[model samples]
Target: MTTALLPWSKFLICALLIGLAGPVLTRSGDAIARLTGLSRSWIGLVLLATATSLPELFTGISAVAAAGAPNIAVGDALGSCVFNLLLLVLLDALSRDEPVYRRVDQGHILTAAFGIILIGFVGAFLLIGRGALDIRLGHVSIYTPFLILLYFVAMRAAFFYERRAGTIAFTGEKGTETGLAGAVGRYLAAASIVVGAGVWLPFAGLEIAEVMGWRASFVGTLFIAAATSLPELVVIVAALRLGAVDMAVANLLGSNLFDVLVIAIDDIAYTDGSLLASASPAHAGSAFAAVIMSGIVIVALLYRPGARFLGIIGWISLSLLVVYLLSSYAIYLLGH
Candidate 1:
């Protein structure tokens, strides 16, 4: 029995460690933003987003490099894309005063746009087939370079736009430089714990897939995706509790941005065939689902709908939740 439960036990412990470190990361990130005179949105976008996304990054590398599971690598990245957007629904419900879309800066639409473009590119390629292009620099897909370039372009655009918008104006009293350094140290320490947990996650996931007779694609898309995304879940909730709405929103959106970039990196690490090409084509469902979800977010950010559906979630959140569930179901059916 103990041997049978080992994978489940490892998964639970990794998840526990990730959840435990989330709040500390949040607090330290908020402090770094305050002390460094950076906007909460920027900090959340680059710093917090990257920190929280480390799990997906490492997991993808491990999945492809060690486990030789390209589907798990790709599924984890794309599934995390969908999973991260679904987080907005949770943020929406928790805000209480108004819809989360209404609380965040419209500038986020830029981040959301970039996420859509990147995700759409992957989905389209998956459907049309990457081999059709016959464009490969060695083993990696031609799409890899484009994805990497676009990610940096997106980051540059966001940084400049945020600066021009004065999002980094630093309105509050700044902390001492020493305080900032301390916060950075603490954040790194907490992140190290998350990293350790993330590294073990894929192995546990692989074992679970084997033991349960589940598809690798399904396991990656749902089970492993959820486990890897635990930090984003906790960070967003902690950010909300701290009243950093923009930070919370940015973290989710920025994580999406980072998630897509992981695909390109995974392509490079795969070293066999193209990463996306090796993945189950069913992942397109999740990719397009995430794209639609992002479009909903853009509309909500623009429309700022105030009315809640059944006085619980806004119409947008309802739409998001529905899409997430349907996509997961489709992946499950396809996996079976």
Candidate 2:
């Protein structure tokens, strides 16, 4: 009972804090976007997305450094991707005025496609492990450097693509304009709250995993990931409600892309071997799941189907839900 209370209480508090942080972050970020003369999509992709993704960053590093559970970190990264994709299920449903995809700019396809590429890279690296030759400089994969490099490349590429895409509509936050410095200050404060909660999340998750006798990957993928990803759900809902379509979509894709980068950070933190080598192959299931859902998202962007299946959401949302469930089950089975 005592052990349960710790994670549960922390989880409840952190989850609520992240939920509160979401709208504040998004609003401040939107004002920052306007002030900086950048598009809301870009702000959502970089600033807001990074702020929300802090949990994964903190949780992954904490899991490796403090908890010695690199697999949990790995699971959180992959599982967070799965969970972020699942958020679109709600995004689509709440966006009942129009199908979600039709409202966003086509530039998002670049973000989604690049997300797939990065995730595929990590998945393939883990799956091939020792079967392929390792160019390791002690503990870290040579690819770790490449992963970091590729992430920046992906960011720059998406940044330029969106720049060229031109004129993304940012539904401004009326009555919330506090000027540039004030917005920056507010964004940072809320971000700190989010990050603080994020730092505590993995510890609780690790304890709960131990108490429950669940595998690190399973616990990380489902529990820790779900907790860390609360900000994404909050921002997505808020963005959708605000009618910032691309902002909502870009946040999820960008967060997933950054989440994969956490693997590189984890690789550095572990000091034992490539973090990939240390984690269960069950994680590749998440990478593959991320790829599959990303593909469907890209398809949704390009296809933009008119019909809402079963009078609710689109085919892609349903497909994403199905894929996530099946992949999660497979990972759990493999983990046990």
Candidate with top TM-score is 1
Model 1 lDDT, full chain set: 0.89
lDDT of 2 by residue, 1-336 (tens): 886787778778878887789889888887787776778789889998899899899888888888888888899999999999999988998888878888887788888998999999889887776545556878788889888999999998987776566643344333344588899999999899988988888877777777878877888899889888998898988887777777888899899989988889888987777788778877898999999999999999999876888879988889999999998898888873
TM per candidate comes to: 0.97, 0.94
Name the regions of candidate 2 deviating beyond 4 angstroms. Answer: 168-178
- Off-target runs (Cα >4 Å) in candidate 1 are 1-3, 170-172
Candidate 1 lDDT over residue span 4-50, tens digit each: 59999999998899888899889999998888789889989999999
Candidates' C-alpha lDDT: 0.89, 0.85
Clashing pairs in 1: none
